[model samples]
Target: MNSDHYTYRVTWSAEDAEHVGLCAEFPSLSWLAATPAEALAGIRSVVADCVRDMSAHGEPVPVPLADRRYSGEFKVRIPPEQHRRLAIEASEQGVSLNRLVSAKLASGA
Candidate 1:
């Protein structure tokens, strides 16, 4: 398997006093090192080993999330009171509820 097909991220960990590498596809594994490069290399090595083991056992490996397509739409459920409040606020702002909610969500508010 090509390691480049996976997403690898290295982030600083204050609690560990080092950089930690994590693979989004393999949530169970992580690696730590003094530098981001070392941490990423360590995780990639681990992923290589895991791929080999899975291949030998005929286990399915997850497809990379980066390769997937996403629709811009999703559904969310809210309490009745919260829904009413949002509807009122949207009306007051002269916008559709969907537009108001989408704007708020996009702004991280």
Candidate 2:
């Protein structure tokens, strides 16, 4: 196993009220919060700690998170012009808008 790289699973649930709900866990880390956003923030903090500890052991920081996966619904507001532009680009690339955006984000990493 690559001790420097870990796979953490984050799960989200709807709350009856306004708060978002989320939790993250791996053999190396665990955290939770009332919202998905909060849970992400909390898990980041925990990962930072894990990284620091690993660094102290004469190890490199965890490998870049290129393979980390995120799946969720999010809303983005773009003007009609920008929306049409992205649609055209997606069509040209033979991919859905979501795939286009995801590919762009991944390439930018």
Give the runs in model 2 whose Cα sits over 4 Å from its true position: 1-9, 13-27, 67-109
Candidate 1: misplaced stretches above 4 Å?
none
What TM value does model 1 have? 0.82
TM-scores, all candidates, are 0.82, 0.37
* Candidate 2 lDDT over residue span 27-99, tens digit each: 4465666666776667666776766787789876645454456576678888999889989999998999999
Top candidate on TM-score is: 1
RMSD of each: 1.9, 12.0
Angstrom error at residue 60, model 2: 4.6
TM-score of 2: 0.37
Candidate 1 residue lDDT tens string, 1-109: 6767899999999999999999999999999999999999999999989988988899997777887679978999999999999999999999999999999999999
Counted clashes in each candidate structure = 0, 4
